[model samples]
Structures are given as structure tokens and as C-alpha cells.
Target chain A: MARKGRAGAALAIAAIGSFFAGTVSTILVAVFAPPLTAIALQFGSAEYFSLMIVGLISSIALAHGSVVKALGMVVLGLLLGLVGTDIYTGTPRFNLGILELSDGLNFVALAVGVFGIAEILRNLENEHDRDVTIKKVSNLLPTRQDWKEMTAPILRGTAIGSALGILPGGGAILASFASYTVEKRISNTPGEFGKGAVAGVAGPESANNAGAQTSFIPMLTLGIPANPVMALMIGAMIVQGIVPGPNVATEQPALFWGIIASMWIGNLMLILLNLPLIGLWVKLLTIPYYMLFPAIIAFCSIGVYSVNSNVFDLYAVAFFGLIGYGLAKLRCEPAPLLLGFVLGPLLEEHLRRAMIMSRGDPMTFLNRPISLVLLLLAAAVLVVVLLPSIRKKRDEVFVEE
Target chain B: MKSLSFSSRDLICGALFIFIGLFFAIQAYGLELGTALRMGPGYFPLVLAGILILLGIIVIIQGTQIEHEPMGPIAWRGLLFILPAPILFGLTVRGLGFVPSLFLTGMVAAFASTRMRPGTALWLVGGLTLFSVIVFSYALGLPFRRFGPWLGQ
Candidate 1:
């Protein structure tokens, strides 16, 4: 197997880019409360629900592996979320008194174990036998055609992500997925995906970054979280006992506005950081699989253990890793499962809450305009998928590894 | 020559999904599920189980209709080691501590390599161990205590 000599350079660039992107987006979300709040003050619950609906659908788009496998992964994610604890009660659901699982599986542990450790296992199995050919050196610059193809998708993604981010749940991640799906569906060339379509990278990347920036709108204005990351931010706020609400912008303008200004600054920072570092990031691809696999395992173990200082998560990681490996062997992509796991609980909780609010009227789903719209969209997708003429296209879309 | 196919395997997988969905439905029934409006604990799982059952039926039907392209027999050696590695990690990780457990795990995993030589493998393992320690402990600042903390400390 030929190693990409420049992988290290490429990886370094990506790391720098991602760091800047992540940090700037975070700061912007944190700082931009007052002005953005004023701008978004008119929105209400329906808008919030629509945003969440969009996020949920879009998150499903993020799985880049086999469609069936991704679906299975999503289901598995939902199952994990449901395994323990009734939200309304103080009682445990599936902890079995292990205590670590009382809170349900930690996201970090699940992510690290399945993605990190299982990846190592797969690499190890293929190490020596696998041909390690790296592509011939090519220019990193995007061509004019590539730029033309990417611009519309990126703008659309930004709009979709920003709008969704203003809602109470479904943050940057969901926006990323939503943007990806939109771009894919609308693109004239739908088949040129999974092979690093510039649109695939550019659009979702833009959406996520923009979504990350906009998610602070609800958190700062109305005191609601758009996604888990924003939830973490809310935790940070609560530690200070600043009960987040509509008045947050009025009460703490600098804290709100500073965070917003920082986002713009942060995006610039990321672009600067990542642009020159791509070469370094690329160089990381050169590391021998032997060395890389072990590192992945070590990272997974460490990441999982740090979540709770418990050794049990380590065991869980290994277990999931095995499951991940098995899924891989079956040619199933694990992305969907991961997404399902993340969204399953939310979907369940929301659906139940809606039912509870409606007091047994099943028509509530159809009667509510927002709910009806989302359901209709979902139906449209299903109908398109079920058509015989689209079967080959569906397979191609879902089975991309 | 006459050919065999994965029709049986597909059929089995489809059946397994259906069974799993039904089991979930049964479990949902045991929960206090309540009225449609006042959904108890089991509403979501019940819905999911129903959906999964539908999907399972589809899979079974599709499997029956598809033609399987023949690939040769499985590589038993690779299969045996690779399949068990994750399980072994799960079984051992908690009690063993990170470094020692990982060393053993990596060593075992290396056996899946088709052309691995013993000496080369040993060197790779050492490099892996060191790199892992430095990157995870030093770079990421993860609290990884070396095994026993006695030999060098």
C-alpha cells in the first residue's frame, strides 16, 4: 500500500481549520444574543417546532454510509436513549443498578467506542493485506467549475441552517444534515456524491458553521437549547444561575453581543487557520495503519473513561466496538445508527409530549399546521423512495460507503 | 457450475428484524402505555417496533427477489480473529487498565495481518504503544495511568 506522503500536512490543515471553525462558531453563538434576539423576537412555538422538524430530517442526511446500515445505526441510537430512565420519574429504566448506565450511555463513550475503536479493529484486520496506495499528488485548489457548483448550495445551506438554529432544538448538526440533503436533492448531478463532491463538503460545512452561529439565538433570547452542544452552553449559564429567558439580551447585552461579534471573528480565524494547514492534515494519511489503529483504540479508551472516571464505560466501548465491527463486516454503515441513537429519544419525548398536550386527539398531528407540513414532507420522501423507477437511485443514495 | 447465493442469509436477517420488532412491541405492551393522548412509557417503542416490522417485511421480500453474485468462501483466519477482538476488549478493558489491556489488544489484532513477521510486528507494537501513550496522555491530557505505576515510577 502506498502512503500519501502529504497526509500529515493535510490533517494538520484540517485540524487548524476545524478548530477555528468550531471555536469561532461557538463564540459567535455565545456573544450574539441581543441584536439577533431583536431580529428573531417575532417567532413563536410553531416556528421553533418547524426548525426542529427540519433539523431532525436533516440530521438523517449526515449518515454517509450504507442507507440500511445508517438506518440501523439510527435505530440503535434510539434504543440506547430509551434503555434507561423515565424523564418524569426519579426511577431508573434499564440501569440494572450499574449506576453508570443510570444516566443512559454517555454520548462521548458511545461515539468514541463505536467510531474510534471499531475503526481501529477494521484497520488492523486489513493492515498488511490491504494495498495502501495514495492518490497522485494534485493541486489543492478548487477549480472555477467547482466554485460555481458549490456557491448556490452553500448559500441555501446557510439559510436553512441559520433558520433552524434560531429554533429551540436541532442545532448546527441537524442543519448540516438538512443542508446536505437539500443540496443533494436539488443538484443537477445527483450521482457525483460520496467521492468528495465539493458540494457535499462545502454546503454541509457552511451550514454547520452557520447553524452553530445562529443556535445562540434561542439560547440567548428565550433560554432554550437548539442541540446538545447548546445544552452544554445552557449548563454553563445555569451554573451562574442566570435563568436564560427573553430578558437575557436586555439584562446582559455585552455578554450576548460579544459572543455574536466573536462568531464573525471566529469564522475568519478558522478560514485563516485551516487554509494553510491542509497540507499538514493530508500528511496524517501517511501514518502506517499499524501505528494508526493502536492510537485510535487508545483514544477511544481514554475518551470513554474520562466521561465518568469509571472503567465500565471502557468495557462498553469495547462491546460497542465489537458490534460496530460486526456491522462493518455485514457491509452496513454505522452513521445512521449513531444518528438514530441521538435523535430517537428526542423524537419519542416530543411525540409523547405532543400527544399529552393534545389529550388523546390523534388528529392533533394533522390539525397542527407545522406537524402536518413535516409529516407531508416525510410522506413525500417515502413515496419517492417506494417508486420502482427510483429504486436504483435510492440504492445508490443509501449505499454509498 | 451451479451457484449458491446469500438468499438464505437475507431471509434469516429479515426474519430476525421481524422478531426483534415483535419483541419490542410485546415489551411496549407491558409498559403502562395509557391512552393515545396520554401516552405512557411505551408509545415511542411501540411506534418504532411497528415501523421496523414493516421494514423487515420489505427486506425479506427484496432478498427473495435479488440475485446474489458469488464470492469465494470466507477467510476463516481473518474472520475468527477480527470478530473476537472487540469482544475480547469488552471482556477485559475495565479490570485491566488502559495500557496493558491495549498492548495485549493491539498485539492480538496484529495477527489479522496477512504478511506480518514477528520481529516487524514487535517493533510496530512498541512504536504503537509509545505513540499511544504520548498522544493520548500527553497531547489530549487524558488521565491514563501506566500499568501499576510501579516499574518506572
Candidate 2:
């Protein structure tokens, strides 16, 4: 019945709906405190890093596309993470002298632009053949049976995510991917894995947010920044002339505690914010296609421009947009490209730091047991990917859309 | 063996990826490529470009080797909605501010059916704008400019 209505409306509603949910969820993690910090400290470096590995594996495994494609994306993300300040030399890596990018592309801008804009383009491109009408949406909430199906996956995901959160490098994003993989691997109804499985959405979401909340513990308590966000927090601390260390908890209890407390507030706010917004967002899905496409482009530009209030970003967005469109036509997933862009500098920095620390010794990776293990694991991943049996399974999984 | 096929679409895409990769690789020559074990600034990008080229080649080969779905013609009308939405949002940022601009953008982006009144779009615009303001501005403290003199401040 709704499909009889309009395409533009549906696309708008879906996009806005997802955006609202994601924003609220993220904000909630930002506000919460005691429990959040307590959660973070549970995982240490090894588990965190191991969980990261799990995340990489899972994200690659669970991707809807071919295994090779997914792995490519994972590598791309890792590569992008590598870009930026070299740990040893403190040199700017890939900013290209664009002030906005000197700090690297903002996640919000990238996320909003790539997914949001790209999606709008796709919808508009099919506007003529498509009816701008509504598809009848099913009942919003999960049924009892749905809950039963989802409950186990959610629990397993939570466990996996929480455990991973305890480790050094593992975070919410990783947890989300890892949970999805675990769900797929262990599910009785494995075939239903990617067909809008509520378990797929729910477990990963819960795990991702929970992991995000916990990632801060090591940063606040142990003074080791686990990821970019944590690094930002460290920057905030340094700007305030506070040196972060193991004793930070004791030395600045209020600041630490206050931030922690804020996280809870954020989380509560998210629940309140997201639930109601879902209705409004769903309602948006009723709009027509003609008016929707232009608006998405406008938003993309606005989002990009906000990064530095510069026109250059507009040009960059256009450039990337064209590139994005081209890649889309090719069936090359842009996710990996973005990932590579993000990680490129970071990877460089880490490799450089390890090398300098080792005094130019190539074997320095081996000297650090943790680093050695990581290297070995990376190698193993490559080897496994090359194995014919695994290769066949991977190829089978990535159905071309 | 099942039949393998490559559409014209696949060929075009492969060519573009390879082109971009080559461009990046060439530009990277100016930047230090760093050492084998110790990475420099250009190392990741250089490697990424190489991989992208390789992937492009693989995609081209795979496209050639597989049975594929037929793609439809370019829907030029659809481009109007998709292209303009984001650009307008950016242009109006400083003038209308985040909330109002968001409202306008959201409204413009939404397409009500001929049977539906404009009021539906209005309501959605109002609703989404308000929610974004509340969540991002009030809750997350994103520090976006509100309406009036505070614009871009």
C-alpha cells in the first residue's frame, strides 16, 4: 500500500531514521559514566587487540559481498587508520595541506557524505522507473519468537564484545562486526544471516555501543589511548595541562568521574531520543523521489563544508562524489577505499615507530612478542585467504548484488 | 562450467579504478615512499594504490568470468533529487543556520505523493529538524550555530 505512495518519501524516512538511531546511540555512550568506565577496564590490551582481530575477521566474513571484497575493505580500513601523524617523527602524513584534513577527514562528514549522499544518488538514479510510493512497513517491534531468536545472539555478542572491549585495541566498531560473525557462525538458521536478521542488527549494535563505552577505561585509568577517540580525550586532557597516567583516577577524580558520569547521561538521553525519533523517521519514508535527490546533495555539501567552512571541501566532496559514483557503477565497494584513506597514515606511523625503536632492525617486529604475534596473525590471515577451501567458501558467500 | 560474462558496465568500472590507482601511484613519487620495514608518509598510499589497481584487475577478470544481471538505463531524472540536496544544505548553512537549513533541506529532500498535501512534507521537515537539533545540538553539544547573529559563530 505504501509503495503505491512514493519513492522519495521512503528513502528520506529510511535515511533519517537510521541516522537518528545511530546518533542517539552514539550520544548515549558519550554521556554515561561509572558503569561505562567500569566496563572499559574489564578488557586489557591483549583481549582488546585480539578482539580487533576478531572484528576484522568477522567484518570480512559477514560482509554481504564476496570474501575477497570484504577482506579488501578490511585492509582498506586498516590502511586508512594508518594515515596521519607518524608516532616517531610527529610528521603530518596525508593531509595534503588541507586544514580540515590535517586532522584527517572527520568521521561525521565522511559517514554522512558517503553513505547518505551515495544512497540518495542511487535512489534518484532509479527515480523514473521507480514509484515514489511507500512499501507497507511491517510491525516495528520484534515478536516474541523474534525475541527468542535474537536473545542468544545478543547475549553471545555482548559477551564477545565485552571481552574484546577489555583488550587493548578492540572497540565498538570491531565488536559490532565480530558479533555479526559469531552470530552467523553459530546460528541454527544460518541461511537467514543477512536477510534483515534482527539478531544481526541488534547484537552488533549492542556490542558496538557497549564496546565504545568501555574503550575509554584504558585511556582514563591507564593513560593508554586505545583509539582515535581516546586519543582525542588524551588531547583534551593535555590541553588542560593534565598529564594522563595510571594515577589519573586518583589525582583528578572529579574530572575523570564527571566525564564518566556524563556518559550515563548521554546513554539515557540516547534511549529517550532514539525511540521517539524512530516514529518520525519512519514517517519520512513516505516522501517522493523528485524532491529528495537534490536535497541529499545539498546536505552532503553542507556536511563537507562544515568541516572547515571552506569551499575547497565542496570541491573535494564533488571530486570524491564523482569517484564514489564511478566506483559504484563498477561494483567496487567504496567502504574499503574510505577505510584505506582513514588508516593509511596510522599504519605508516606504527611501522615507522616500531622501526625507529628497533634502530632500523627489520626484526624489531619479532622482538616485541605482541607485535610479533600481530605480524604472524596478519600473515596467517593472508595464508588462510589464499587456501583454496577457504577461498571457495569465501567466494560462495559474496553474492553480487 | 556455468557461463561467464562481463557487461560493458564492468569494463568501464575496471578502467576507472585502474586509472585512479595509477594517478595516485604517480603522484606518490613526489612523496617519500619510506623504507620496507619502516613506513614513511607515502608508503601506505603507494601500497593502497597498488592494491586498488590489482583489485580492479581482479574485478574486471571476475566480471568477465561470471554470469551477470542486466543493468537498466541511466535515470537522468533521479539525478536531480540526489545531486542538489547536499549542495543546497552546504550553501545555506551560514545564512539559515543548522536547524532551519536542516528543516528546509529535509523538507526539500522529502517527496510527498500528488495525492498528499505539502503539509506532510512540512511536518516531516519540522520533526526531523527539531530532532536533529535536540540530539546533536542539545545532547551532543555539536556547537553548531543556531539561527540569527550566531550564524557561523
Candidate 3:
């Protein structure tokens, strides 16, 4: 979306379509993923705890750069997450006499500070260098040939996304990446993969949308969130006094069905508004960093304040802004940290519960077959990351041969 | 010398990690830290802190041994303007109400950017203030006072 030039229109159209596709997929999974319903009832605390560890590891896989730095950031995020009043004891952990800090740091503040402000700070240094090309998007829709090329890839992507989306640690990101790999392997014009093939856009777009929607499976039915967005949704549900779990479907059918109805309506609105508003979005991109950033700051501040009409959240955002920038400078990506932050409390809760249930034996994690599998999966991911780098180092030595 | 150079960025990062870990670990020390079987609030935090401290050491080692790009100059101006703008809003929002506070926040932020002209800033602020009022107060019906208690309520 940030890149300029000729492929922009196709990318934009595909992205817009993907938005609606994502919405449809979410509803489909919510209604149809029966296995997820079963898993919700069956999962013990041990299994859930193991699953969270797997989610943490999988998120680590998503971060680029040194493992040590990424892991450190994840830990930092976890520690930050540990702030606020302990649920079990009702005593504040790191509030330090500040009454506002008792409820913990506002997530919106932290997110906006990290993602919005830190990003702007990074971009500001290169403000003079960035060339925002005002290229006219002459074509509004995909051509018939474009549609033909997209169809197969889209179907294949949707399939890939929908399947993976049901997994505990899986979501749109994994789906999109997996679909891209599959598309590249199966594509007839494999050479065109990187250089903006129609299938490239179509496949990932569909898959991303499908994955986004289907990833809600664990969130809605099972109560265990797959990602930070799902965690936010869970938080939203809680604020509305709805406990998100398997029983939610039967107990509050209106809320469940209302969510489904709203999602479809939102998709329809997005499809209608997006293209006509593309010009507006493009115009927004053309705004200079100096002007754009202040606006962002203003909006983020207002949004943070609106969360609880509190001023303390502003300080939290500022503090996190510096931390986020510092981590980014150290080549640590924030996504894994965000994921870790979202899942940290749950991980602690489940781990404690499982341990208590199993009489504190460390072997209980290994004793449970499901928990054992999850641990093995996490170990496998670590090895996969380690093995490839080792091979690449060896390959460098053999290049002359 | 350049080829064998270390990254101060990584060194600072390592130190930061260690510092944060140690801080938390020490704080948790006073708390009840039960065994892993029947863990206390302090136990999990201690474990995480230990992991962080270990990772920090590894990071420090890498920083001292490996060659990487020198850390670039910090955007101090952006940081100064961006960081304070929100604080200013928080301080003033309750006093001045949402619209004026928003305008002031926008103005302060606008001045942060050396490139933004005064006339453009004024126009932009005006537009934004209107938009925020409409969207937040009128459309969304958010609970912020338009005039505020400070103005002789």
C-alpha cells in the first residue's frame, strides 16, 4: 500500500475485495466451524496453557532480526503486561501509588504510541527523502483477463486460509504467508510472482481475507483469542458484560447473531465506500509528514483519552512511544511483543491453574498428550529457524564449487 | 577498525533489558514467590525477568563481537514536539473542553514541524477542530464537555 507506481490500482482493487472477502470468511467460520465448538468444550487448562506458549513461539517466528533482541522485547512486553492489579489478589502489582495505573496501562494508548507515533518518528528522519508520487489511478476496476487470472488463485488461497485459520495460533498473517508460498509453487507463471502478477494480488488478498474471517473461530466459540485483535474483541465483549465462551452462543444468541449481522453490513458499506474513497485515501498519502504526524498525534491522544476519559493514559502512551522507538531502533519488530502482551495474563493464569491441578509436578505438562504435542511443535519451530541459517552459512562456503 | 566495530545500539539495548529485568526481579523479591508447583505472583515475573536477563547478556555479547550499521541520529525535534503535544491535551482537555483543547494540541503539534507554514497550520487546525467536534461530540456522542467546568460552570 505504501509503494507507488503502475501496479497500484490492481493492488488497491484486490485489497478492497479482500476486505469484503475477509468479512464473509469471519461470518462463515463463526457459523460453520463445528470442530472449533467441540474443541472449546474439550480443552483443559493444561492444553490451553501449552497452546499459549505455542502462540508466543509462533509470534516470535513472525519477528525479523536477532532472536535475542526479539525475545528480549517479548519479555519486556510480558513484563509491561504484568503491571496493574493482580486479579487473584486484587492488589496492585506496579501501580506505585498512582490510582490511575491500578487498572493497568490502556492498550489503545500503548498501541497508538508504538505503531502510530514511533512510526512517524522513524519516518520523520527521512521526511526530505520520501517521494510521494501522485500517479493517477486511471483504471478503477480489474479487467476481464485480470478476473480470469485471479479466480483460481483466489479459490486456492481461500481454501488455504480457511484451513489454517482454525488452528490455535493461526490467523490472517499465517494464512496470507502460507497462501503466497502455495501460490508461488503452483503458479504456471512462477517467474511473474514477485513482479506483480495478478494471481499474486488475488491469491494473497483472498487468503488474507479468508484467514482474517476464519481466525475468529477460536475467538468467538472457543473464548481463546488467536491474536491481539481477537484479544481486543474479547475485551470489548467483557466491557459489555458478556463473558466470551462456548455458552455465549446459546446464552446470548442476539449478541452473537448481531455481531454476524453487523459484519456483513460493514462489508457491504466498505465495498460501497472504498473505491469512490480511494482518491481521498491517495490524497491522504500525499500529505507531508510534518502535517500528517501532528494530526496523528492529536487523534491518538483524543482516542486514548476517550477510552476512559482519563489523563493518565496519555502519560502511558508517551512512555511506551519512547520504548517502542527504542525497540524498533534495536531492530526488534513490535508485532510479537504486542501478541505477547495480549496473551501474557492468560498464559500466567493457565500455567498456574494447570500446575495447581497437576499437584505442581513439572512433568504434568509432558504427561498430557496434547500439551506434549504443543511443546514439541514449539521446539520444532525453534529448530526450523535455527537449521536454515546454519545451512545458509554452509552454502556461503560452498558457493565457489 | 570499522569492519571489527561493535554496535552501541545493541549495547544500549542489552543494558536496557538487563536494567528492566533487574528492576522487576527486585520488586518481586518482597512478594510471595512460591514454588513452581504452587506459584505466587512473584514466581512467574521472576522467571520472565531471568529470561530477559539471560537474553540481555546474549545481546551484549553480540554487540561487542559483531559488526553492524552505526545507529543513526535521533529525531530529537520530532520527539520533543510529539511527546509533549499529548500531555498538553491531557492537561488542557478538562479545563478548556474538547474542541479548544484539540485545536491547541493540533497547533502545538503543527508548530513541531518546521515545514508547516503558520497560515496552513491555522487552516488545518480550524478544519480539524470542526471535524473532531462533529465526529466525536455530535456524531459519536462522546461524554466530553464542550465548554468544560473551568469556564465558570
lDDT of 3 by residue, A1-401 (tens): 22335444665557655765766586676568555666667888888888777767766665566667867877887887888877666657766777877777776777777877788778765557777677765565677777788778877887888777766556777777777778888988898876767777777778877776777777777676776567667756765678787777777878877777776676667667776776677777777777676678888988889888889888888888887887788777877677677677777888888898999887888998988998899888666655767436433423411
TM-score, predicted candidate 2 vs. hidden true structure = 0.62
Residue pairs with backbone overlap in model 3: A26-A213, A360-B37
Off by over 4 Å in 1: A1-73, A94-100, A121-130, A135-279, A389-391, A394-401, B1-9, B69-102, B110-112, B115-153
Q: Where in model 3 is the C-alpha error above 4 Å?
A: A1-9, A12-24, A239-241, A390-401, B1-4, B64-66
- Identify the runs in model 2 with alpha carbons over 4 angstroms from their true place: A1-59, A67-108, A128-157, A164-303, A382-401, B1-13, B33-44, B71-75, B78-81, B84-153
* lDDT per model vs. reference: 0.59, 0.55, 0.76
Q: Pick the candidate with the highest DockQ.
A: 3
Residue range with the least summed lDDT across 10 consecutive positions in model 3 chain A: A392-401
Candidate 1 shows a clash count of: 48
* Lowest-sum lDDT 10-residue window in model 3 chain B: B1-10
- What TM-score would each prediction reach against the true structure? 0.69, 0.62, 0.91
In candidate 3 the C-alpha lDDT for residue A124 amounts to: 66
What digit string (tens of lDDT, one per residue) describes model 1 on residues B1-153?
123334554555557567767877776667776667766777667777777677667666766566754332344444455445544554455556556666776676566655556777677767877877787767887765656443333
* Native-to-model Cα distance after best TM-score fit, residue A140 in candidate 3, in Å: 2.2
TM-score pick, better of 1 and 2: 1
Q: Rate residue B33 of model 1 by lDDT.
A: 66
What C-alpha root-mean-square deviation, in Å, does candidate 3 show against the real structure? 3.7
